[model samples]
Target: MSAMVDTPAAQPLPRRTEGSSARIGALAPLSSPGWVEAGRHLLAGLESGVLDVNDAGGVLGRPLELVVRDTAADPQRAAAAVEELAGLGVAAVAGEYHSVVARAAAAKADALGLPFLCSSAVLDALTDRPTDWVARLAPAQSHGWRIYAEFLLGAGHRRIAVAAQPSVYWESGTRILREHLAPRCGTVIELDMGALTPEDVCDALADHGATALLLLTGIPEPAVSLVRSVRADRRLAGVLVGAPAGQPEFGPWAALLGEDGAGIPFLRYLPERLGPLGARVGSALRERLGRAPSFVAFEGYDTITVLADVLSAGELSRERIPASWAGVAVEGTRGPIRFSRVPGVGVRQWAWAPVQVVDRDPAALDRFRVLRTG
Candidate 1:
């Protein structure tokens, strides 16, 4: 972990007249195949924070409510959701997972002059533009890829092969890995997994003498197939396999991949070890939802906490929210959360967010272990 930097605190702004409710909009893929459970976790965090605030006399002495909109993992639907949320008079908007949907929502939120706090979208390009109203809770793809590169180098993997799906999220991460790891490694082979079969991937790994394979696809079918193919081939048995941040959550990947999912490392927001605050939040979530909190839940809870802090300390209106966030810092489940305006990346991004490499224990697939942190 890095030392926390001190940033200026938000200045108090004039309070608005008392209202019955302070509503914030939440957008998530509640209908998408792999994202429905993630959306539930996000909602759990948002609702938990809202309930806590209401118990503590709420923001501006009014109850805070969440207006959730399902994006269906579609860009067009996400943009439309932004319009609906804004028309409903939400003070700000938060929550999203898919990068495509988040990018569309961020643009719409900017057009509507609403503060949009991205929860888990990690594509670098989402925040690679000049949008003051947009801020991300998740670490950018570059941050995670840097950690992946270091892990590979530390493991003495000189010849690295990357298998990726041709999505915006995977493309951004692949580019980062190529730029950072190419010079360090003996050779870097990039393959489009969408056009290749499992046998084709195995053949490339063997042909290139790859010591490590990085799978950058978020979809489970390809990831599972590739892992199975890698495991089945004794010739490639020495090759270490991993994913970026695309593996499925809450044990589905484990169940689907069976023994194949074991020992496959990937970058994730939450570590296997929880801090005091993380443990408390996890306990609360489990008790309320009857399941452990997922990484997305932690992000959702933290996003609302940051928003509430800004809204309570500064002006309650949307106009001052961006300025309020400029200097604000709050403790989240992961660590201290703050925003920065990177030159080329998105403006107001939570640049210092933590990421870790996690893998399922081969003997116990249900157990996940944190291998490295950054």
Candidate 2:
């Protein structure tokens, strides 16, 4: 079950409905071409205890139910899904994947005064939203880049090399780099690999070498192309360090990079640190889906955990939820997660999990240890 949608999709504008209830909905590309696998994982997580819905803070005395609808990755369809959920009288929504879709969905959720928890959308667009009802669980990619820059600069490396895939995430990373490096008294050379072919990406990597390299982009295909190509370069053999893509999609690349990727830092919440309950979640997902869970599973899990915590505090209302979320923090598979009221986006801090490449399992890692590498 790959998590992808139909080819040549379009916008899905969603509308709100009157009245609100305790029902919570998950809007995503469940029926999309490759999404069945991820959708099943999400469903499995919800069915088991991973994304278990709290009984409206356990105050309502009735177990909460999660209603999911497939957006097919179409923006208009995504809007329709939210309209339907809003019509269902849902109090909140927990969704997975894509910052673009999340932005549309979050807009709908906010109009209805329903709480929106973004499990996978990392685009600053999603986080930069000003809605009080919206909160992003993932740390800002900029924060991760800033952390990476600090570490690389402090190591006494004057010139730095960076590679990006021209994604919005990569663009934001580049922006952060310029801002951070410009002010930090450090110099850097960024390798813009956007629109570059696999061979071109590799050549770019081989061409540049000064300090640590920051490969910014989560697109697994091209990232794999470049990582393998550059690691093979004999001249650049002993490059100091590299930061994995900020998003977990780079898990596959981690395995490809092997030893050099050993000290590669990424943002993730390892299953081990999630404790007894988190492991149970991993087992539950594997049992149902028959494949190990990754960031996708953890994302859904974190969203529910956070919403449940907020609900448990008191009645989940528009104003109250954000108020409580102001100082709230939850340890998720990604890292210590929290959000602050950033004028545009409701909450601002994204967590980082510095994982070292142990062996073949870039997908599976040593414990998610938080080190100040970025």
Candidate 3:
């Protein structure tokens, strides 16, 4: 006898409790290899400050609770995570480190009409997409590329060799650098990161007589390898090696390279020169994690703090958050945090995010001196 097939009923979406707590969703790569600690630091920042709303008198008289979800740095998983967050009835969503995952989650959040404030995803296109519900705390790669190009040119490096990994973030940054440097520099050689080994890259620099080498990659392994190779080769001694501000694994980079990482500069959002607020945040982070906070950690802390301020001033709802955010100007760990619609990047995005150049010298490695700000 043929049996009738059983159909499972769809699960109901989570309803807002309408009580003393307001829930927010955080989507990040908590299980991934490189970004797991970043996720933890983000959570720690929230719980220690904004999420402890009850002690701080709460936002709109409601304490904040963060609902954490791991995206595993996967695009599909990121999209699903957004849906799950919406189903759980969060006031809004935030936190993502990977550019691909952030892009996916941004689209999902926009379609679902949820507010998403991206923390550390620096891919230029993350804010370039046509989405009104999404905003970024980190400056786009285009802005960062401009800063890097200017820094190189100002340092009298005319012959520049670019080595970039094959990824969305690196590719976009490489393109921007080429555009900005072509007219200004005497010679700019573009090298595909995957096609060449560390030795091959150094050899190309030696062959071209490049004065400076710009290594653009998100992963620490390739950057560490390239820096090591360059230092070992005596011929390429004077070439100034630099990296962009996307690598969150800087602690590992410092540990692996030791003194070799010295004189190698990279862009960063959080300069060591902190104001009163920045100093307080840094101390709190050190206490919680047993070390100073990374740029990603600061981004997470600021994102929640911004959201809390917005929620406190106006009605607590996803629809109202964007409008509220656009009007307020708050002091972040970096500096004044504000949002505006740039010509290229999307609306309500924080375009004027500050950046600095930090070197990895053994004696002064921790000193994140400000090279340039834009």
lDDT of 2 at 309: 67
Query: Native-vs-model 3 lDDT?
Result: 0.75
Q: Per-residue CA lDDT of candidate 1, range 196-237, in tens?
A: 998999998898888889877755667788888999999998
Give every collision pair in model 1. 127-346, 128-346
Clashes in predicted model 1? 2
Best by lDDT: 1
Model 1 regions lying over 4 Å from their true place: 1-19, 246-248, 271-273
**Which stretches of model 3 miss by more than 4 angstroms?**
1-20, 127-129, 246-249
Candidate 2 lands at a TM-score of: 0.70
Going through the candidates in the order shown, the clash numbers are: 2, 27, 0
- Against the unseen true structure, what C-alpha lDDT does each candidate score? 0.79, 0.57, 0.75
Arranged by TM-score with the best first, the candidates are: 1, 3, 2
